[model samples]
Target: MENNQPIISVDHVSMRFNLSKEKHESLKEYFLALAKGRLQFDEFYALRDVSLKVMPGDFYGLIGLNGSGKSTLLKVISGVYKPSSGTCRVGGTIAPLIELGAGFDMDLTARENIYLNGTVLGFTPKYIDSKFEEIVEFSELRDFLDVPLKNYSSGMVARIAFAIATITKPDILIADEILSVGDFLFQQKCEARMQRLMSGGTTVLLVSHSIEQIERMCNKVAWIEKGRVKMDGPAAEVCAAYKQTTK
Candidate 1:
């Protein structure tokens, strides 16, 4: 499928952030300074001329050290952020588990949030309704369905998030270390679900610190370094090269 049309085309994309040079203690102070022209910003490029192609059914892995802009690139591909330059074109439906509680209402009950989050992930109300019981069963939150999300543990939130995101077979699944918060058993469940997704021809864009997982799951790997793609190639080749950096 490498020779086929790309499922995801990221062409020379760049994401820029303007860092406020001055820190204000409160929103009032920040807004006051902004209105008076007393604030300054420094330009930062989270992604600089980064380009890559993810073909249909490709299980792509992104690896990097902390603060290397891996998440930013995911956000760009997820359409949470518009690139400052260039473009990212994604084909088909996307289920993004990039940020837990992203589309969730903390004050809402887990039962309510399932419909809420599912809609945000692009599921139609009727579709979500049909899959409601299945999602709840997978999440193992049938008992906690009425609990407010804010009161749930991180692991609990992760369970619901993963279950909802994977409720339907999305064309692409974007995950960012969400499994790391889950217990070992739950992580295994998430991995199993991902494996099923792969079997169904779903393209997956995953960011994880676990090189072994990447090596096991990804046919292709992209090593991001300081907002740029340092290496992009076969999983074995790029993982071996990336491993040398840790040594």
Candidate 2:
């Protein structure tokens, strides 16, 4: 039974990006246009007056058509993007698997980047050392440990990234289409790991296009359409309504 307490709160959040209308061929030309005050920008709002709450231990899903601000909302919640208006707050540490290899150094060896990324996520050196082997094993890249990450395949990169992010339990887990990049088997493995984390009271916020997956894994769903929430409630109801519109 979830109380009224919210672990993740997004209140009237709005995100805006300024896009330049003209692209200058060189830096010199760009500066000249800027000096003349001739550059023009179009303001685009990715999210508009969006609000949401996830209580402790809730399995939340975000579903929408592409460019419907699903990923933008997740980025805002993860602190990667500051909301143009309103606010987003999280109660605890977050493990965000939003973009593949976003925290990794491509030029560095997998082993080196593991420690680097782990530390960035707030794990102490001693804690990372304890989970070092487990990370390598889960990614199944034992022989490639010393190899530079740039040489790794996309799937290989996804493996290492997912492995490192889930190595230690987190208070909140945010994933954005991360499972789509991996093979089916690896996706299944990820789902199993997420289940275990949820059982331990880790709140999950997931973005996936698969309605079937959402209904199966999430207790609640929010349908975002054209930068606003069109529906929010029990997963079955929201997902069923969303599916109807798409059909």
Candidate 3:
């Protein structure tokens, strides 16, 4: 299922956030700070000038410490956030499982939430209708589908979200630390589902701190630190280098 085609190309992309220290202060004070050339503002560069490529069917791993910009990179690729500089070209359909239940309505029933989530992912009502039963079955929430989402446990919500995400059969899938959800048995099922997607030619970008999971799941890895890529190559080698540095 490995296509020898490039699916994503990121060229010298950088993302920055400008932190204004005088948001609550008066305009005169802010102008005075600027006039004095001592403005108390900071620039937080979440992702420095970084470039990378992902090919179709590639299981790409993004390994980094918290605040190292791994999640930022994923968000950029998924079009949730735009880069401040440089260009990112993504081919094919993309599905991001970044924050589970991000768009769910707490007051809506599970079934209603499914439709809402599916619509956000670009599925038509007919398409959602076709996959409704399958999604509920996969999540093992058939009985709870009629219950309000507010009544569901966090684990239950995550399960439904995961099921809805994978049902789209997207060409590009970006998952950020989603594997930490659910019980042990459910985690196994999710892993199996991911394997199925990979084998079916879906390009996956996985961001995780778990070295073992990265080694087991990804064919290529990129290690990031302080918003920069420290190492990029075969999964085992990159992971090894990361471990040595962290230790």
Q: TM-scores of all models?
A: 0.92, 0.94, 0.92
* Ten-residue stretch with the least lDDT total in model 2: 1-10
After best superposition, candidate 3 residue 125: deviation in angstroms?
A: 0.7
Candidate 2 structure lDDT: 0.93
Give the per-residue lDDT digits (tens) of candidate 2, residues 1-247.
3456799999999998887678787999899999999988888989999999899899999999999999999999999999999999989889999979987999999999999999888899999999998998899999999999999999999999999999888989999998888999999999999999999989999999888999999999999998999999999999989989889
Error of 1 at 192 (Å): 1.0
Full-model lDDT for every candidate = 0.93, 0.93, 0.90
Highest-TM-score candidate: 2
Candidate 2 vs candidate 3: which has greater lDDT?
Answer: 2
Alpha-carbon error at 105 in model 1, in Å? Answer: 1.2
Better of 2 and 3 by TM-score: 2
Q: Candidate 1's residue-wise lDDT over 14-41, tens digit each?
A: 9999887777879998999989998877
Clashes of each: 0, 0, 0
Error of 1 at 206 (Å): 0.4
**Candidate 1 C-alpha RMSD relative to the actual structure:** 2.4
Candidate 3 residue 142 Cα shift, in angstroms, is 1.7
> Model 1: which ten-residue window has the lowest total lDDT?
1-10
